[model samples]
Target: MLAHSEWKAAGEQLENQPVAGEQAALNQYAHLVRRVVAHMRSQVGVVADRDDLQQIGMMALLKSIRRYGRSLDEQFESYAFKSIRGAMLDEFRRLDWRSRQSRKEAHDFRDAVRELRRELGREPRDAEICVALKISERQLLNMRYLEQAEVVESFEMLLEQQTHFVDSNEDIEQLEVRQLMTQTLALLPERHRILLQLYYTHELNMKEIALTLGLTESRVCQLHKQSLQLLTEKLKG
Candidate 1:
């Protein structure tokens, strides 16, 4: 039975992976792994095998632990959530073709992307994907419907209930956009970055950020607007 503080420490340990504390680090994430597996089994249906998911999760945990940092100026949970979910989603996609009957062909396209990356060490270009999957532009465009439907539906669910935002890994396309946003934040001035972080990540109202920063609320609003404009430009670029 891990106490709240214990769990938090475990998270911290996992985040700051050191050679001396490797095993201890693994122990800390034990609970997170178990919880993810149980949640997947219960919520994601029996489409993917339990053992497979666990293995995928362990790989993800390792990646998270290795890449985890204490100083991205964001919550550790937010970063780990994406990594863990991504690993599981990768596994889910790999098993998708075998798990379903009617959608095998459509699912195979995604599976091909996964397999090719594993084999080729990078994602193939659109032409390469078409060649590998034996898919024409028309077929690829049609497949977008299936893919977009799932992405949009999941995004809607996340917006409706923020809790669901941390559930599964986001698709690769969405993940890129998210990474872009993080990079955009890094390019902004420290004040602008702090303002957005406090307002959005910390869920502080504008007034709260203003009070904490000792600025007028209107000034905070101005900074936020500038930050948004910069972020929007970076995203477009």
Candidate 2:
């Protein structure tokens, strides 16, 4: 919730020089944006920058403030929240579409490994694999990224069983907390969710994930950290 004084100041800024006054409004909006971004990061996963989210949110706030009519009969925060969140969601959707290829590659790699294991009596050596597949190291590495989600426990079996994750009571409770926090995540942009799922569920380290997703490793790491921090805080609560 914004302080009354903060709201009043933003309102005044909106009326004064809507465009030029945005800086002032943004200052106030930053607090609200941070709260929302923090909440979102916890639920889904960090795939977007808090600052980037904040900037988009500010744009949404400006849009709301500019279009808001005295007769709308809606609370300003309610209206602004929807607008700001929508903007961020829109951006997220765009990003999600872009990362689809990496996801497919990951899936295909898993399928290929399963098929190869089934055809061969024993795991093929790297040289035999090269002769059989005729793929370069880069291509193989790309496929390896796919296995991030499906780990082979013994690494010796032709068709390894999927590993089961047994969460501790604490982890289960924390997951519940994260679930509550990320309820709004489904409403977020697709890119944000996809990136988060890949980063968290796939458990791809930053560089590998980045290369797979065509993003900078640093950006991926930062988003990953931010997303984890958000989830931690929400679960703690």
Candidate 3:
């Protein structure tokens, strides 16, 4: 969260004398903040405060406009969507909403799943994981939900960090990072690659992606998690 003074400074900057179509662009695209908030609310579920996310989205919008030189275009919309979503996710990370015990449970659950996968030579089924962990199916699902969020957040943060250094004059290290990312992505299955692109690049939620791909939401979630895990492992290697 931004400090009170920081918010005020941002407001003052945006409210200053307009440059040509800046005001018009602001007015025209003001609804984007709301749209982003609504989409994010659905994605994050009810754990996050709608009003707080909206405020963050608005601030992100102001920053995006300034960053893009107050121009409104198709490209600007994509840029602002990513900016707003990134800001909201950053807040979530800062808040650390999950309890300490919950995080531990999630970690244990993840470990159990990985162990079962290694033993089974494939992704473990829900029943297999529940039995192995001595947990109920409901508990297993809850852990999976939490782990899904953690995985997605971790993957996004990694991408954001890597992409930050990508530029025309990027050094060899940065170029290698980019190449590694591309190669890792290419190694994923076609469906996994498509799912990652839709979720991260196109910013589609799980439900929307399920509908688009003609799969159940649960299946989509599974693929999403698997895809991210593969990317994370390969990239880290």
TM-score of every model versus the real structure = 0.35, 0.33, 0.68
Overall local distance difference test of candidate 1: 0.57
Q: Sort by TM-score, best first: what order?
A: 3, 1, 2
Candidate 2 residue spans exceeding 4 A from truth: 1-24, 42-45, 71-74, 97-237
Each prediction's whole-model lDDT (CA): 0.57, 0.52, 0.72
Model 2: lDDT equals 0.52
Q: Among all windows of ten consecutive residues in candidate 3, which has the lowest summed lDDT? A: 38-47
Q: State the displacement of the C-alpha of residue 90, model 2, in Å, after optimal TM-score superposition.
A: 0.6
What is candidate 1's CA lDDT for residue 1?
A: 100
- For candidate 3, write residues 1-237 as lDDT tens digits: 999999999998867645666567667777887766645432354246777777777778777788776447678887777678778888888877677876797788768778899999997776777688888865654565676777777887787665644355324544665566677888888989999888766777776888999975656777888899999887777
Encode model 2's per-residue lDDT on 6-85: one tens digit a residue: 99999977665446565665666556565455434422232456667776777677776667655334366555664565
Which scores higher on lDDT, 1 or 3?
3
Off by over 4 Å in 1: 1-20, 42-45, 71-74, 98-237
In candidate 1, what are the lDDT values of residues 57-141, reduced to their tens digit?
6667666666664433345555555566556765655565333542564476668768988888975555666788888755654
Cα RMSDs, all models: 18.6, 15.8, 5.7
| Count of clashing residue pairs in every prediction | 0, 5, 0
Residue pairs whose backbone atoms clash in candidate 3: none
